[model samples]
Target: MPTLLLVRHGRSTANTAGILAGWTPGVDLDDTGRSQAAALVDRLTGVPLAQVVSSPLERCRQTLAPLVEARPELGGPTVDERFGECHYGDWTGRPLSELALDPLWRTVQDHASAAVFPGGESLRALSHRTVAAAREWDEKIAAEHGPEAVWAVCTHGDVVKAVVADALGMHLDHFQRINVEPCSVTAIRYTPQRPFVLRMGDTGDLASLRPRPAHGPTASGDAVIGGDTGDTGTP
Candidate 1:
């Protein structure tokens, strides 16, 4: 089996404001975000990573910049639009406060799995795209480098959740069941058989925030941070 490491981009100004930046473009990571990326780099310093792929967004690329610089032998990170954030359509760059005031906003917050943005891609659609892209990448790795290839992908939070849900064979309705934090690293194992999410939404120790190699396979299907369920904040 091959290992796939999925990392969410670090905190951004828009993220702090709780606004939907979507594909508005040019959003950069903040200071704390840079620190988190550095932490990740420290963690993965000893790990042998085969390839690194990231969203075309500046934030995603920046998240992997340091790692590429440190390990020039690993080559440059590949840019793929499929790993980009979910297109918020009409809500792009809108203030979260204003959007929250709308009735539809509640539905989005509560049941985003099925809710569709007025002019944006549906959550389900986003999940499908992510899953397909991931599968293609897995196949390419297997064909080009054999079964032991380990790859890292840098993407947005929502996109990571969608990909996680799809990998776990969960329905779109369970989108909220997974919460992807900025600069978090979630590891999974993908095989020809169904996708097995060995781990999901784990930021690892704050002390080592940068990308690192996983020591062992997931024995239990669990998450480090529990998601906020409608009825209760439970995993």
Candidate 2:
């Protein structure tokens, strides 16, 4: 068994501008986001990460920079596209207000398992791939670093939500009920029986959440959301 730390990238330029970043390129951390990234080092001070994985996108990479710099023993982050942001396809860089008015918006809020972006992936597909990828990595890390191994994966908001939903044994449609803020940390430990979620959308200390034995375990709709943080807006 291993402790998997799920981290949502910090706020970005797109977030402040109210844009949905999706897989869009050139999205970097905003001033506030840089502060959040820097603060992450302190937050994760005592947690020893055997491996640091990340989405191949810019924001996720930027978010992990500080941690990578501070934790040299962990080397660099291994990029895994499966853990990347859900493909929005045609909806990739649109405004949240515009997307809210789309016919699919209600489905996203109500029955996410059935909601697929016009030219992109479905929510069900998202959960399937992300959940599988997490477990695969968990097993690999455990074999390589030992059962007490601890790892961190820096990914997107919806991706984080989907993983959390699966760990909680909730249906995909209810994944929207979870909200993870920028730089938040969500930890899950996989055991022979089930996955235990140690923390959910935590924005505080990681010292308390350090690797242990088998443990148990944002936004939008009324407001707005992004792939990086609130992944509800665009590039």
TM-score of 1: 0.84
Task: Please give each candidate's TM-score.
Answer: 0.84, 0.90
Model 2: how far residue 64 lies from native, Å: 0.5
True-structure RMSD, every candidate? 7.2, 9.6
The lDDT of model 1 is: 0.77
lDDT of 1 at 99: 88
Tell me the whole-model lDDT of each prediction, alpha carbons only: 0.77, 0.86
Number of clashing pairs, model 2?
15
Candidate 2 residue lDDT tens string, 26-107: 9999999999999999998777789999999999999999989998877889999999999999988899889899999999
Clashes of each: 6, 15
> Which 10 consecutive positions of candidate 1 have the poorest summed lDDT?
226-235
| CA deviation > 4 Å runs, candidate 1 | 205-235
